[model samples]
Target: MQDDALFPLLSALAAVYAAEPREEAGRTARHLLEAGPSHLGAAHANDAILAEMAAALAASDHPAVQAILAGAHLLPWGDNPVAAQAAAAGDIYVVCTLMGPDGPIPSDDFRMGLFWQRPGTYYALHSHDADETYVIVAGDAEWTAGDDTRLRGPGEAIHHPSLMPHAFRAGPQGLLALWRWSGDVNTHSYRMLPDPRAVAAA
Candidate 1:
């Protein structure tokens, strides 16, 4: 898809987020939308899985939602090499970042993206300086935040406080979620707890 395809997607994403009943989430979405430019570029790392996800979204009742996702720039899960290794082993973890300090329309205050993981994969415990929120757009997962854990499915949103340890494992059906971050957007602040290398070795 052309880079111009991203404008509608960004607008839709911002609309959905701005309509969030939660005050904080709505405010954050509006802030990002207002500050971000309409330009976007492609990362194009995972073509096959991107097609699958687009199809799945297209099949949903919300076809417009799928249209928005169709323009995503799929990214390799290589920022954390050990996690990348797990994905290489057929787990199908995919990341599509939409806005960040380094993304198309750069922003220092927040970032938003889509994340997908195949069934049975463990997204190891990790923490970051930015407060994060994940709104499940498809599939299911067992989500953990601090000592709290729950089975979150489509339409549910999970929030993680800044620097709070959390992790999740995709259930039998796999997981697909829309994620947003605020407060701190530094990429260097992400810390994988227990270590990705250790998890890979185990």
Candidate 2:
């Protein structure tokens, strides 16, 4: 049952990556195409935000965004494995890995997935060993990397080098993005840094 939706979802994502100008995007596209359809069962959680994410994606004009929304119901959504503490802080987000080591389509060296965050949520500063890139498929966000910050909307891309501190606050409509990780793609090194606002208050 999941394979029915997974195939089209992955195919659509491949098309999205193939159209990107980055070499990494091209490689990700090839990986997706080679993986084919596979099922990992439903990993769904945080049901409340799923509907909001779907609504935001549905409002987007991007084709990739529309494709994601169409297959969202079948995707294996799950919580953040690396930062469990974030949930306690009311910073909730979900992930659906289409291709990666733990995903239905296994790839040790890279990971490609979708990420959705609730509206007005702030994901505090964090860093990891993996080199990551996120392309906004729907909604908007204020992304911060080190000292730089920018308001990013649909179709924009943000890159974070290995171990570089980064964070983001979702816009009123929330955020829906396609993300990929490569180079030291291990969650073992993932760590959340102290929130600057808290530090300032102290």
What is the TM-score (0 to 1) of candidate 1?
A: 0.75
lDDT of 1 by residue, 1-202 (tens): 3535655665666766766666667865776566543434335656666665665555444423564565554332323212433434345476666666775546677677767776667777778888889887766777888888789876677889899888777776567777888887666667667746336623
Model 2 Cα lDDT, one tens digit per residue, 94-190? 7777777776677887887888878877877889899898988889988988789889988877889998999888898999998889888888888
**Alpha carbon lDDT at 98, candidate 2:** 71
Candidate 1, run of 10 with poorest lDDT: 76-85
Error of 1 at 191 (Å): 1.4
* Per-candidate clash tally: 0, 0
What is the TM-score of each predicted model, taking all chains together?
A: 0.75, 0.88
Error of 2 at 153 (Å): 0.6
* Each prediction's whole-model lDDT (CA): 0.64, 0.78
Error of 2 at 22 (Å): 2.7
| Steric clash pairs (candidate 2) | none
